[model samples]
Target: MHRTRRLVPAIAAMVAGAVLAAGTVSACQADQKPEPEQSAAAPVVPAAPTPTPLPSAAPGTAGPDAERSAWLGEQLREIVDAQHFDDVVNAKTGKRPPAMPNVDVAVIELDDTGRPVAAANTLLTQKHPHGVAVPVTRDLSAPGVRWTHWSNSVWAAKKSTEPLLADRGDAPLEFMTPYPASVFKLIVAFGVARLADRGGVRYDEVYDYRPRKATCPDGRKPGKHSVSWWLDAMLTYSSNTATCALLMMLHERDGVAPMNGALRSLGLPTLRVVNTDPADGGGWSFWGLTMTALDTSRLLLLFTEAPGTLWRTPKGDPVTVGVLKRSSRATLRKMLRDQGLNQALSTANWCGQDYPAQGIPHAVPKRWIDPATGVVHVEDRTYRGDVRKCADDAEVEFAHKTGLVPSAGADAGIVTALPGAKPRRYVISVFSNLGCTYVDFVGAYDGACRYTEKLATLGAAVDALMTKTAGRATATLVSGG
Candidate 1:
């Protein structure tokens, strides 16, 4: 079914206002509480006792529940078949906007230890989706594995007549498409965290804001800040300047090599962090980084059990490693938990109208002063998008990242069903070339709002499936003697 979600203010307008109000803000910032300054990193905690090696269960006998896997697979298929990609037809243009023709989706159930549970009797090999399947592997032996591919011709039927900004012949395998700022921020966070864990960087260490070529999307340079401060800004506010500074730091310190190497060590080679500075032979303004939905999803699964979690090595052997120190992991999670932006996946309707707030810690009061006019607007959750508070409904927490550029929009995160509800945890990652930068209901049709609604629908459906099958046992096969 085509679900409709309330439309929030256009991001382009927000960017314009931010430029007038404060020149350093990016287009993706939303009204939320100010994050406290982190002059010092959180104290690191000692490693916990090593966990026992979890035996890989025979398909469907143990590990992640097979039923859940089957349910998720069906949901993905339905979404692809429903053709939500081109549901919105532009009234004036009389053409459907471009979207990610190849909509890739993956949902993996995680055990308490955070390793992917093997789903029994699940379809490991996907059939030809959208008439052609992109060249990618579905590693059943890898932690949390299930892959599905599909494309809607309607979305891919037409491309924007807009001239290409930069066309390097043929995108690389990891360069599915230049992901948006939000997704890039997530990758930068992982790289920085990995560096800190290896003692190559420190969270509290201050650095001068320097960039080879990258800066805020608005062309302003960011001020100097600590590694932890930049991380908080990048993840929480989607600050392009902060993202650029961190990326520059990574490049100067040769941090990208280690981050990509670490991902390969975990058996993910298609995911990579690139240098966006064009002067350095990278397109800092255009296509900076490349990532896949499945790889992105798997990376998020790691966060579910970071700081001493057992995972698979590149050789498929079991290994327990602390990807992030307990303090580091906790600090990052808190920043995401209090994320000011919730208009994308977190706006999905989990509980009904009674509890409007779909995500965690009821929507707080939102107040913003118009920098252009000096008029202060004070309303209860007024400017903070359409999501409202629901104290009674099941509280779900979405600690994830979202991306929005003129040509593409993406959202990926770990969805957790909090207390007072059946404990269900899963990771979902979605990416598309959909144009979600249009102003809502003005010169253009509400395609961006509709696209967000479609994502919310998927989020709601995933929550339902996970909740319904929570605690259900994996289907087991018995031999007839």
Candidate 2:
């Protein structure tokens, strides 16, 4: 749901030319009472400065790797130049020149053997009007990069809960929105999995959603449902209510004390849940959770390298930890791959899974149901569709998660080429607040769509760099095929 907050005066000036979209609340929070309206709009500040191009290889200098690196650098520069946020600003506000915000990019490439062969880290910068090139800061919390919330993946990986299948019986796993915990449901599902692991619950356990006495702070009654339904809704459809139910069940079974202990044992003591769904709370949205890009990248790496160590302790001891069982990891990866929303990372055209498929699989059909009366109001079962495509036509595979808030956008995951070729994989994480503007409604400016296109373009550029360099190098390094 849309919660209004005062905008920064400076951001207002920067985006004076932007056309604000009509304000709309989240459909997921329809059950909860509307929050008090906010009076002021917050300034939508840009994060980071324009990226500085990677240095080119001196003419006729060095070896083949150097030449490939130089060529890749040039390709990257072209990609960065194409994303000049100034162009967006200039188009919106013709009077004043736009300032260039930085784009934070991290690319790690693995060899045919799955070992890191090369890594590139750089910040692109644009020449200022005064002819000076300033570097953009890598602040994770900056308005430009703050929209990313990769912690959901970690929560899903570490959450332990009881299977709820027994209690659910033959009940259908379905419900109406806005379901709670859309993205946050991963945490709740983990809790349920843990419960099931300990013999405390079953996957069939059913929960009623009819309004009744409950623990929720919003005084809202639970929907007619069960744990299994909620878990599926949370991951596949991002149901808000289902997420709340899972969190509440986990806490009631045994406070977060057990969950926190599990985190400590996994070397993630800081990743803890502190609040219920923001849709049910009175505060800034997403303030209930905290995370950083670096931590997120490390978590994804752990998931990818499960049953293996991502790092070692300062004492030289290997910290081999697998957050989820191999089966669970596979399940989560499948869920991520089957994500209903494909705007950001999927736009890269590299998510080789069945992306061209139309409509979300588990999404609740559009209909009106009164929780109070248990009566049907309206029924629209037609599936909504997503038609965005990658700029390039090449098929690439990626298992990734994307995060979006009012002022930020982010994506992270593992990418690999099609089979047959030496299996090379890369872990790419991108966080950006460059063109994110505070709009009143969920469908605000077209800028977010443009930003997604930019991300897809960058993904393509990175794919080219890895394929051209490593593909050629490995071909030459290997013996006769």
Candidate 3:
């Protein structure tokens, strides 16, 4: 079931007053912070007002549930206040805060049966000093793997059956960005999977990454690889070129309209798939291709829950609800489990890991083809180092996806708490558009690292809260005036 809560005007006013007062204090003390001043990039463009109506349950449930919701709302307000303080400090010091100055978080705790025990959406509505309001930004690059509209679109198009390929008739797919491997690979994988299901293309079928007639600004070609290899590279390593190749193949086969139609069918008409990837060179804003944390959490629930239960088609038709087929879900889950970038949510701290030695592979082998010479070059791409570990050894299995670009960092997934008698599983999605730029610092990117640490701490706190409150009749925390 879907529900939303709108802060009553008086509560909103009080919260805003407290946040702004804190913001003022931070602004005055900005001179104390250190910095290698970077020009302020454009602030996040605020998301359009959420269309989901306020919760109707609030009026009737005046005792425990109401108190719990109010407590959660207060916590959210405090978080927003902290963010505002960071923003003010960053504005004064001209240094990017290691912690995101602005962020949007959604946390949901689900029972064994997949019913939500508690859920919260905290969207920061403060404006930057430059006057731009931070939108509920979701330029969650790697995290996109979890709920890419295209994946659902492909499933809808094929209707859980074989995919039929329509003729492209000579339309050339232009490269939108210099880097399209990750997203392009997704496009291609879905297309190929569709074709494979229909007997048109085999997963092992090797496709030439020849940009022969395609409009490629960088004039890059894909290395010779099978469809399956491309899919693995895209999902595992997040290869941009691999994503591009897949997008081109999809354009050649069925075109973009089907994907858009699929999004609408899945009850997410606003989630757009305009370009292949960010590197597509389209003057498109990354936030334009975004989703709210609430929507994202719901999508994750659909993925983790039983099939044919939670979602419906746009026409109110009962479509098979699970986002992925059982086998496909297993494959996706395996990939997510094996994902090495655990810096965001499943950090060494939250889900304990061996630091630089165990987290991300030092160097991942990558191959790129030059379009001009038709030559393939193999190279090793080194990843960033692990920053910090959790203070306590927490044995939590988080099957998650992390997305990070210069402007944003996001981590979303299913959290399975294994330490207790009754293991708890829930979904947590955190998206941050902090003021910190991604510098090439291993653990020294203090601002970014701090932000991540805060996020992990928040996750841990929420997990603990849920664990303590589980099976309790009422929330234990008393509401303060």
lDDT of 3 by residue, 338-360 (tens): 44445554444212222211221
Q: What are the per-residue Cα lDDT tens digits for candidate 2 across 1-481?
A: 1123223211112223333221222331222223212212102222223333333223332111333333333444454454433333322222222233334455544445343333333333232211111111111111121122222212123221222112323332211000011223334445566566576665577755443333343455467566666666555444445556666566566734675555445443323455443333222233343333333444455445423233433233334324445554565556555544444544422122232111111111112223443232322111122212221332455655554542334556667665544344766655543323322223323322223234554555555555555543331211110
The residue-by-residue lDDT of candidate 1 on 41-105, one tens digit each, is 10011112222233334542323334344444554555443434444333223233343233455
TM-score per prediction, in order, is 0.66, 0.53, 0.56
Better TM-score candidate (1, 2): 1
Error of 1 at 181 (Å): 4.2
Error of 2 at 338 (Å): 0.9
- Could you arrange the candidates by TM-score from highest to lowest? 1, 3, 2
lDDT of 2: 0.38
Candidate models: Cα lDDT each: 0.46, 0.38, 0.38
RMSD of 2: 14.6
Model 1 residue 331 lDDT?
Answer: 68
Top candidate (lDDT): 1
**What 10-residue stretch in candidate 2 is worst by lDDT?**
173-182
Model 2, C-alpha of 21: deviation from truth (Å): 12
